[model samples]
Target: MLATALSASIAGVDGVPVRVEVDVAFGLPGLTIVGLAGSAVLEARERVRAAVRNSEFAVPDRRITVNLAPADLPKEGTGHDLAIGIAILVASGQLDGERLPGTALIGELALDGGLRPVPGILALVAAARAAGARSIIVPAGNAPEAAATNGVAVHAADSLRAVVRHLAGVEPLVEVGPPGPLRGEHQARLDAPDLASVVGQRVARRVLEIAVAGRHNLAMSGPPGVGKTLLARAVAGLLPRLEDDEADEVRRIHSVAGLGARPIGSMQRPFRAPHHTISTQALVGGGPRVRPGEASLAHRGALLLDETLQFRTDALDALRGPLDSGCVTIARVDGVRAIPARFMLVAAYNPCPCGWAGVDGHVCGCEDGARRRYQARLSGPMRDRLDLHVPLAPVVSGLRGRRESSAEVARRIGVAWELQRRRQGGANSALGADALDARLGFEPRLLALLERRGRQLGLSLRRLHRAARVARTIADLEGSSEVSRDHLDEALLHRPKDAAA
Candidate 1:
């Protein structure tokens, strides 16, 4: 007898549909699985066999051959365990596989006949639904996440015995209902550090607000004691909660990353701050498994690299492409996959090796050559990609400025963001050259002033365009439709300085 069952696996952040085909013939007793199965998938045979026997199911002494079809697709993980077991039972005349045509079976099986939760269950359920699967049987532990996906009925099963009984018409499994609809826009639900906790450095606070409001990439240069890290953390909370579509996409990525067990609320946005010692592969996402790096994990949110100069030059440079294109394409031996990395970058660093090169009233101790070498870690192209560059001064003691709370600042930022989206359908930082010229063209005098300054700064076309975008954002923040000379001047002041400077 021959039988087939539906199963799914994760590829990159999405899911791949696989058909578990089982054949039980009148030959010597043996089991074989094929179809480019990975080590994890190959190991599922023992699990399924033990689970079936432990569940009190009779094992026939027949030749068994399992094929995962469309044989071209590679299969991995123990997610196929339950499906393979079901297919075997059906082929051995124990159950009717044809009865569950459009149903997907996805779970790991334990020796005790128990069903175990697997990673990427959400993505698998989504793929099952897309492949016309009306129902999905998953481990009870994964039912909550699986139930969040729409357009599919979820059956949460606990053990192999329970599943067999359910399929045998002895006891029906309870269906899990869909979760509540994701939170809508216009709701501020981020749990982040309060901006009012940061005292002094008024300039840094204002720049942080502009960065968050426009989704601009910002670089902060200052001594260790300044509020650069604090400002970067606060930006995460100032940004609005993830929209419905964005939250779903983010959840899919997290599911593939094995972070589904974490308490990630639907509306929360990601804030990834990798240590400086992280390897290039880890930063950009590539290893044996080819998981998402910090950049991809920070999709639709922020990636803050504190002590930016301390990071490996190659690791820091790896972010250039994703920063510009808003996505990371990783080419593996298997194939190429693109991961979404539309994130605001916030990089902070000291001025020199000694960390006092640009500090007021402080003499630098590092040699000129060492300072140059230390600052050179931030390559020119990388600097050009980061738009806003603000130099911070040490905080003045007992002179705390009248700081606005994060709520107050976020309100103003939300207004500016809404204006930008209404006017241009995106944040100001995302504006292209054509859009910049068409929507926020500068006045003649302002353009002339910017041109002269560009010559003095030896700014490349990319830099000039980035400055223009920042100026547009500044203008937007001020409720202005056109870029003014004041806005252009402020944008230039925020431009990144040379290493020696």
Candidate 2:
């Protein structure tokens, strides 16, 4: 006899429908799985056999052949265990195959017959719905994740026996209802230490707001304890909450990375602060399993590299393409996959090895060559990508004054962000050269000033475009219709000083 069941597997944060085909025929007692099964899928043979027997179902001692359809697609993971087992039971005449069509079975099976929740259940359910599945069977632990997706009937089964009973019409599993919007404790914000926590550095605070409001990359250099790190953390809350579409995109990436629960509930943007010792593959997403790295994990959010000078030069350089293109395409011998990496880069670093290259009172202990090499670690290309480069000074002693809070800055940022999205349909940093021209519409005097400055600074076309966008963002914050001289002047102040030097 033969039977076919619908199943699904994950592929680059999405799901692919898999047709689990099983055939039981006369021959020596053996089992084999074909259709380009990865090691995880092949190993499912023993797991399914044991789970069937342990669940009090008969395991036919005949030649059993299982094939995952779409032979060209590489099938990995243990999600197919339950589907293959159920297909065998139906093919062996123990269970009816009538209910198998238009229903996706997704889960791992333990030796004792319990169904194990698998990662990417949400993506699997979404794929099932896209494939016109009428219902889906998932592990009970994953019910909440599955329920979060719309337009799918999800049945949570605890064990293989329970699934069998449901399929045999003996009893029906309870259906999970649609999950409501994330609220309260479920929506944990990233540790955005309040902007007001930093006692001073008013210029740095304003620069941080502009960067966050426009989704621009920013870099800060200062001696130790000058509030660079604290200010970096404060930028988190300055960002508005993710929109519904953006939240869904971020949730999909986290789900594939096996980052559970928090992303689904929070709707807050991702904030990834990878250690400086991270490898190139780990930073940009590559390993045996091709999981999402820090960059992709920070999709639709911020990626903070505290102590930017401490990171490996190669790893820092690896971010250039994604910084410009808003996505990373990691090509390995196995296959090439592109992952979304549209994130604001917030980086902080010390001025020198001794932490006082140019501080007035503190004398630098490191030699000039050491200082040069330390600064050289961040290449010109990497430096150029950061739109705002603010050099901080240590706070003056005995001057106590209150600064604006994150809530206050966030309100202004929210308004500015809404203006940008409404006017240009994206953040200022995302505007291309033509888009910048169309949006800025500066007068001849402002245009002449930019052109003359571009020549004096020897700014690359890319940097010129960035300056125009930044100026436009400044105008938006001031509620101006066109880019003004004051806006251009303020934007110029934030550029890397070396651009003029």
Candidate 3:
């Protein structure tokens, strides 16, 4: 007898539909699984056998062959365990296979026949729905994730027996309702550090607002105690919760990365601050399984590198591609996959290896050659990608200027963002070169000044465009109808200084 069931596995943050076909013949008592199965999928044979026996069902004493189709696609993870088990039972004549059609089964079956939540449930369910599955059965614990997908009836099954009973029409599992809205946007939801608490680096605060408002990449260089870390962290408080479509996309990527239910902190925006020691693969997205790296994880959010210079040169260079394309396009032998990495990059580092190279009242400890080598780590191309580079200094004295709360700052950012969305349908930083001249309301004099100053400074077209975008954002913040000379000059001033500077 042969029985088939529907299932799906994660691939590049999305799900690949798979058909589980089990054949039970009256010859030998061996169980064989084929069709590009990974170690975990192959190991599912033992798990299925034990789970079937534990669920009070007879494992047919015959040759059992399981084939995951389309057989050409490689399959990984224990998510196939549940579907494989169900197909085996039906092939063995223990249950009817009629209910298998138009229904997808996804979960990892424990040896004791209980179902365990699987990662990438959102993408998996979405794949099932896209593949014409009317409904999907997932682990009870993953109901929230599975429910996040629309156009499908989600059934939460606890144990193998419960699934069997539901399919047998003896006991049916109740369908899960759709998940509630993701937490409210921005400051209302996140308990992040308040901007008002940050004593100084007022310049850093201003740069952060412009960076977040337009989703621009920013780099900050300064001495050790210049509040670089504090300002970068406060970016979380300043961020608005992701829009609905963006939140769903981000949640799917994080789910495939196995961080869907991480915490409420991510509800607002994912703030990924990778350490300096992170590997190139870990930073950008590639591994044994080619999973999403920190960049993709920070999609629709921010990726902060605290000790920017301390990161591996290769790892830092790897970011240049994603920075330009707004995603990480990884070419692997299996195939090429582009993971979403459109994010605001925030980098904080010292002016020199010793961090006091230019600070007052502190003698630099490192040799000039050593400092040169340290600064060289941040390659020129990478620096060119950073839209703003604000150099900071320590403020040892008491606060002099007024320190506005994050809410006050975020309100202004929100207004600017709304204006950008209405004008260009996105942040100013995302404006294309053609958009540089379209409807941004740039003054004729300001445009002439930008072109003349850019040529004088020998700025690349990329830099000029970035500067223009920043200028547009600055104008938006002030409710200006057009980009002025002051805005253009301020934007140019924010450009990263030369490595020698």
Top candidate when judged by TM-score against the true structure: 3
Tens digits of lDDT, candidate 3, 67-151: 9998877788999999999999899889998888999999999999999998888888988899999989999988877887879
Q: Poorest 10 consecutive residues of model 3 by lDDT? A: 182-191
RMSD of 1: 2.2
Please give, for residues 331-397, the per-residue lDDT of candidate 2 as tens digits. Answer: 7665787888999999999988889978998899999888888988888899888898899998885
Q: RMSD, each candidate, Å?
A: 2.2, 2.2, 1.8
Point out the higher-scoring one by lDDT: 1 or 2: 2
Which sequence of candidate numbers ranks them by TM-score, best first? 3, 2, 1
Off by over 4 Å in 1: 182-191, 261-265, 397-401, 441-449
Pairwise TM-score winner, candidates 2 and 3: 3
Leading candidate by lDDT: 3
Question: What TM-scores do the predictions have?
Answer: 0.95, 0.95, 0.97
lDDT for model 2, on a 0 to 1 scale? 0.85
Q: For residues 1-501, could you state the per-residue lDDT of candidate 1 as single tens digits?
A: 999899998788789898899999999998899998999999987888899999989676899999998787778789999999988999999887655688899999999899999988888998888888998999999998888887888999999888878887889899998776644444443556788788787788878887888899999988878888888888777887665677887888878877782323455678889999999988888776667888988988889999999999999999999998988888878888788888999999998888898677999999989998999999988988988888888877637557688878878888888898788777888888766563465766776777788999899888888888888888888888889888888888888776767
Give lDDT: candidate 2, residue 338.
81
- Residue ranges of candidate 2 with Cα displaced over 4 Å: 182-190, 261-266, 438-441, 499-501
